[model samples]
Target chain A: MAKTRVPAIEGWFTTGDEPALVGSRGKETGSYFFPKSVAFSRNPAAPAEKLEEVALGRRGRIWSFTTNYYPPPEPYVAPDPFVPYTIVAVELPEEQMVVLGQLAEGADPAALKVGAEVELVLGTLYEDDEHEYEVWKWRPV
Target chain B: MTDVAILGVGMHPWGKWGRNFVDYGVAAAQAALADAGMEWRDIQFVSGADTIRNGYPGYVSGATFAQALGWQGAPVASSYAACASGATALNAARAQILAGLCDVALVVGADTTPKGFLAPTAGERRDDPDWLRFRLLGATNPAYFGLYARRRMELYGATPGDFARVKVKNARHGLTNPNARYRKEVTEDDVLGSPVVADPLHLLEICATSDGGAAVVIASTDFAKSRGTKAPARIAAISTVTPTYPNTVIEMPNFATDSSAGVKPPETTFRDSIAAKAYDEAGLGPDDLDVAEVYDLSTALELDWYENIGLCKAGEAEKLLNDGDTTLGGRIPVNTSGGLACFGEAVPAQALAQVCELTWQLRGEAGERQAEGAKVGLTINQGLFGHGSSVIVIR
Candidate 1:
């Protein structure tokens, strides 16, 4: 039986066929935030503006990328016999912000380059007996 | 701004001694006091940098160090600014002296870090950006360093070999630094051959965490003169500014850069503005600096700092390195006391350690690592969450 898919962290991103990161936009300034800033406006110039929930751009160009050779310390859950993964910083043209995400599984680090286009996708972050933990990942296009 | 004299600077050396943090702090404080030719009771104020790894004592480090040195009831202040903690503490003491609240102050920072990647506080807090980055993306400090290094490669044609050369130069400089943790000379090949911890950055290219402490004694110029000590190194400025709105560059422990979609990005990037503020207050520019001690968190980061601190233009750091302009005997020698490349990072202690190195150089007491006739010096570093650290010292 296939395990139930659950977001590794809830409300940060949607888990679906065409997933998009959940973010917030300042009502007054139009600035964007990932993982949604619910409390206040992060923009110093537009402080006190209300933030509205919005979906960030699903696609962006790679600003830079790196591959982590060693497993990071917990609360990072590593797979048994941990596999190395590439992390990418993607610049969203609409948001004008660079957001970091793990490159989707099986994407070759060598195949990636600065300015390469990538889209958001839900990937298995880890798994348990009854559930598959999913998190937002970047897939090179 | 009025200048605060650096009466003396001292360090307990950088190494993994595995001792209590207090031991290192006391030793460094004693050394600084002795170097200043003053008694412990003479200090009118104490400023200490906090270490998160240790418990309550580390939190109230100012009183901890004071009590360890037999408290004289001096007013105490403790600051925590991640890696910029030392500079924060130093600034606190400088403020008191400049405000005439005290004639003399002791500033100290020490840490005993764990082995391996510095982890976030043990918890499952989704709100903390530091924890979220590690839990969600598994991005370590070196990972950020790797990203910047790769960006350099793509934009300015920086090579792995160029990064290795930075380690090679720093290792050679560390050979003459008694306080340096890694004093052995290294070659470019040795650095390049080290195991890769992060792409485009080798294990040798990254700084390790170590147990260390550093301290400085600062006083008003009038106080220095009263003590019959003339011409001491004067702190011309200390810049502890935060990032302006729309900090476009991605910083550590953060999953995203601030969106510039709303406000126009600042003319100066966050890192560039760190030292710019210091230069503005000091009435000096990069050309005025005879020597510098910048945080080389990673070899490639040092190259980035060359441009960040205005030593050279962006994309021209590699050329500056190739020209030997930043080496020990060159124009505007940088990291002359080996920097974090050799000292490793004691977080709270590292920034003050930079000031200690500059004070030694300005006093003409630095032995083999001395930058000759170095009358002006600058130190710059950035801490997590927008803590900018920069200090300018002149003799």
Candidate 2:
């Protein structure tokens, strides 16, 4: 039997034709938070209210990016004989916030630059016998 | 309220020695005690910077160090705030002095870090943003530095050569300081030739991690007066401010910045607010600073701090460096102790090391790299987790 698919960290993204990242919108103050504010509102001016979960915009421009030369320590699952990968900070227009995610596989330093348009896609981080963990990655559009 | 006077300052020279942190803390504490012309028993209070990597004893470093020093039963407090742990320790001691709880308090910070990149503790806790940045994005600390360096290049036209120059300048100062980890001077070619850790930042331009210890003896002004010292370097002001809402800039250990949809960001940036608060309390401005020791985690970050500390206008830090205004014998020398570029960062001990430099400069004790006629000095450091601190010292 094939492994089950699950969000690497739940409540961050979903699977669809054009899956979008998840966030929360403050009904009182129009504030938006990624990973959806579950504890409390960060805004000082806004009173406490139930935040509505919303699917974030699919597209954004790369604000900045860098390729890591070394593998990050565990808790992070890197492929055997680890290959270096790039990370991009993407700025969503509607949210007016920069979200950081890994650039898609095969992406390198020469390809990405500031202000380049990027879109999100769900990718596998690592897989076990029972489940294939997934995370959001950025691809040059 | 009465003022707090730093009766003495001591540091076990920063290095990568494999000795235990407790020994370093004790050595620095003994040195400070001797310098203050007092015994350990005379200290009425003790405050220490907490090192998280160590076990539970590390969490209560104050009592740990106190017991190690033969336990006179002094009130103890331990504080932890990433790199600003030392400054937090200093403030804890200062509050005790100002409140008349202790006539004299001893502050100490020490750390023994690993060889390479400071990684998050081994865990599977997903809620921590620090761990998520690494596990999810593979964004190392230098990755953020690279982003900032690239942004500076695009926005301010800063070149790789300009970044290299900062290393050259600091390494030169490092040669004059006996305690620095890297004493060999580096040139612009050295910085450029170094392997790229992340996009715009080279390995040479980023600071390393090391083991070190620093301690200071602080007392009430009345106590200092009774000790027959008419003048001692005073901690005029300390700013321990948090970031304002709508934190636009993505800081270290954070996956993303706050969304700016509902509330507008504050005009005073996180770094700016720290310096402003210190200045307001000290009744002084940037013009009054004769010397400054800033956290230079990377060469580009140093330039950002140049503007953040009000040494220059927005986007004018490169010009300040080009004009020789920030070097020794200039308008105001920064990082006179060679900064983290040479000393490397020792976490809890780093901020206290900055204060030690300012204390030496204020007292005319800084030997070869001392800024001339330095009467007032300031030290600024920003740690992870929204902890920013600035300490102003005056003679």
Candidate 2 residues A1-141, lDDT tens each?
999988888788878889889888888878788878876887788757668889989899988887777666776778888877777889998888888888887666687778889999988787888999889998898
Clashing pairs in 2: none
lDDT by residue (tens digit), candidate 1, B183-275:
988989899899999999999999999999999999999999998997999999999999998999999888999999999999999999999
RMSD of each: 0.8, 1.6
lDDT of 2 by residue, B69-186 (tens): 8988899999999998998999999998998888999999988787788888776878888888877887888888888888888788899998888888888877878778888888
lDDT per residue for candidate 1 within A1-141, as digits (tens), equals 989989999899876678999999999999998768999988888799999999899999999999999999999899979888889999999999999999998888999989989999989888889999999999998
Model 2: residue A46 alpha-carbon error in angstroms: 1.8
- Name the DockQ score for candidate 2: 0.74
By summed lDDT, the worst window of 10 consecutive residues in model 2 chain B runs over: B1-10
